[model samples]
Target: MSSVDVTTVGRGPGLVVLPGATRRARHYGAMATALSEMYTVHVVERRGRGRSPAQDSSYCLDAEISDALEVLTETGSKQIFGHSYGGLIALHVALRTDLDRVIAYEPGVSIGNTMPRSWMPRYEQLLAEGKDARAMVHFLHTCEFMPGGALVTAMVWAMQRFAAEGRATRELLPTVVRELHEIYALDSDGSRYGAITAPVLLLGGGRSPAYIKQMLPLLVDVIPNAKLVVTPEFDHNAPDLGHPAAVADLIRA
Candidate 1:
C-alpha cells in the first residue's frame, strides 16, 4: 500500500492526479471535484508533503516514480492527469506502465537545455538564507508566473508574509528548489519519451512562460501517440487555481 495521502472522491474507474511542486493534494480539490462526476479521482500528495514521508538522501527521479506507481497500484487507476512537475512524473510513469491516457499540463520535462536555470542561484541562495518569500518572488518572476516590475514583486512579497496560505506555502518552498533540481538532474532530450505507449494529450497555457509553451509541440512530436492543445483561456496554474473545471473538461475529452 502506498504511504502517500491520496484524496479520494467520486466513484468509477480511477484517475490519479499528481500535483506540481509547491502543491499539496488539497490544492487539487476543485479539479478532483469536477472530475469526480465522471471518474474516481485520486489526488496524491507526493512524498515530502502532507502525510506522506520525505524522500531519503538517495532520492531521485526513481523515488518520485516509485511513489506515483504505488498510488496507481493501490488505486487501480488506469488514467492520470498530471500538472506541472506532476505532469513530468506522469510522462515518466507512462514509460513504465501502460496507462489508458496521460494528460500533462505544462509538464516540466526539460528537453536538452530548454528548462530555465538562470534564476536557480538567487532562489537557492535566498532559500539557504531562510528567505523563502524572496525566493518565491524570484521564482515567480523568472518563471513568468508573476509579472510586473520590481516594485510589484517587492510589494507582493511584503504582503505574502501576512496571508495564511502564503505562510503555509512557505513550508513547501524548499521543495520547489529540490524538485526543480530533480528536473535538472533528469534533464534530457525528448528521445526517451518517444517510447511512451499511451495516448497523450499535452495541454498548455497561452500565457505561461515562453519556454513552457514552446516545449509542448516538441513533446507532441516526440511522444508517439501524443497531440498538443493550448488553452488560450488559462495560465500555468489553471488546473490548481484559475480554471480547474475547464481543465477537467480537457481531461474528460
Candidate 2:
C-alpha cells in the first residue's frame, strides 16, 4: 500500500476526511477539529498537495481512491466525509471498501452534459496566457452552481486578487484543472452507485447550484441506503471551510 501522511485530531472512533479540488487537507482543519471532539479525525492530503507526494506520470481517479483506501486502512477508519470531488471519491470507496457510513457533500458527479464542456478552451487559454488567477476565476464562474450575478463576479474578482497576492492559489491551479478534468471524465451514470450498501448521507448546500440539488435526489434514489440533507444557507464550500461546526454537527448526528 502507498504510504500517505494524515493529520489526526480529536478522539473516538476513526473518521477519515477527503478534501475536494483544493486537495489541501489543512483547508478542512476547522471541520476536522470540530469532528475530533467526537471522533479521531484523520484528514488525508490528496496527492500533489501538502505533504503528499506529487502526481505520477499518469493521473486517474483510481489512484485517488487507492490513496484514500490506504489511509483508511492505516487508520482503521470505517467512517468518512468527502467534500466536493472528494465526495465522489468517497462514494466509490464505499462501494469497494467495508465502510459503515459515508457523507458526500456535492460530489460533482455530472449527468450527461452537466459539465460545461465549452468552457475548457477559454480556461486553457487563460492559463496559457499566464493569467492563472483569471483562469481559476473563469473556471469557478463556469462550474459553480450558485447564482453568478454580481456576487459571483465580486467573488471571482476577489479570488483573482487573492491568487495574485499569494503563491498558494497559483500553485494549486494545475492540480485543480487536472482534477476537474478527471471529474468530467468520470462515468456520470448513477446506476453504478446502487451497488453501494453502506449508509450514505447525501448532503447539499441550499445555496449551491441547481445541478447539485438535482444530483442529490438522483444519488438518494440510486443508493438504497442513502438519505439527503440540504443546508439551505450553505454553498458547496460549507463542509470544507465554510461552516465547520454545522457540518460537524451533521457528521456527529
Candidate 3:
C-alpha cells in the first residue's frame, strides 16, 4: 500500500484503472491515451509486474484492495474501472470504501465454484519446475475458448516462445496462478455484492467467455444501484487490448 506503480494520463477528474492478471501498465497504453482527453486516468501496474514489488508469501485479495485504496486516496479519485480480475477488486473495494462510481469490465467474480480450479495442481507444479510455457497451457485450457483444441494449445506454446505476449502472459504465469486462487477463494452466489454503495456499471464484452457473460447478469441483479452494459463488438481483453477507445466512450457516457 505504500509505493505502487501507476501510469497516469490526461487532465480531468481522475479515474483509476486496475489491469487484469498478467497485464502491465503499458498494456493499457492505448486505453489510457484514448481516455486522456476526458479523464486523468491512472493505470496501476499491479504487484508482480513492471516496477511494482513482486507478490510475496502472503499476497491475497486483501493485499490488492489495500494497494487500490492507496491509489484512490493518493489521487483523491472516487471513480474506478477494473478489467477482469481487476474488476473483481474494484467492486470489493467499493464494498469497503465510498466511491462516486464503479465500473467493472468483465469481472472474474466466481459464483459457487464457477471459476474452475481443477487446473491449479498441474499449473503450479509446472511453474515450480520452471516450465512456465507449459503451465500457461493448463490456465488457457480453463478459459474454455470454443473449439480451442490442439491449434490453440500450439499457439499458446509458440506465443510463449516467440510472441511479445510472452512477457505479458507466459512469463507472468506465476502471478496468474495466485490471482486465480483469490478468485476461487471468494466464490459465492452473488449475494454479498449488495453492500456496494456506489452506483455501479457492469461492463461486459458480448463475445467474452460464456461463464463471464453468465456472471454479469447475476451481478446486476444483486447490486442495488447497478446496470449491465454489453458491447457486442468486444471481447474480454477489449478494454486494454482491442476496444479501448470505445470502452472509454462508455466510461464517460
lDDT (Cα atoms) of all candidates against the true structure: 0.87, 0.81, 0.86
Residue pairs clashing, model 1: none
RMSD of each: 1.4, 2.6, 1.8
Which regions of candidate 3 deviate over 4 angstroms?
145-151
Top candidate when judged by TM-score against the true structure: 1
Q: Pick the candidate with the highest lDDT.
A: 1
lDDT of each residue in 110-132, candidate 2, tens digit only: 76556566777887888789876
Candidate 1 wrongly placed segments (more than 4 Å): 148-150, 153-155
**Per-residue lDDT of 222 in model 3:** 92
Give lDDT: candidate 2, residue 139. 73
Q: List the residue pairs that clash in candidate 2.
A: 145-209
Q: Which sequence of candidate numbers ranks them by lDDT, best first?
A: 1, 3, 2
How far residue 211's Cα lies from its native spot in candidate 3, in Å, is: 1.0
User: Over the full model, what C-alpha lDDT does candidate 2 score relative to the true structure?
Assistant: 0.81
Runs of candidate 2 with Cα error greater than 4 angstroms are 145-166
- Prediction 1 global C-alpha lDDT: 0.87
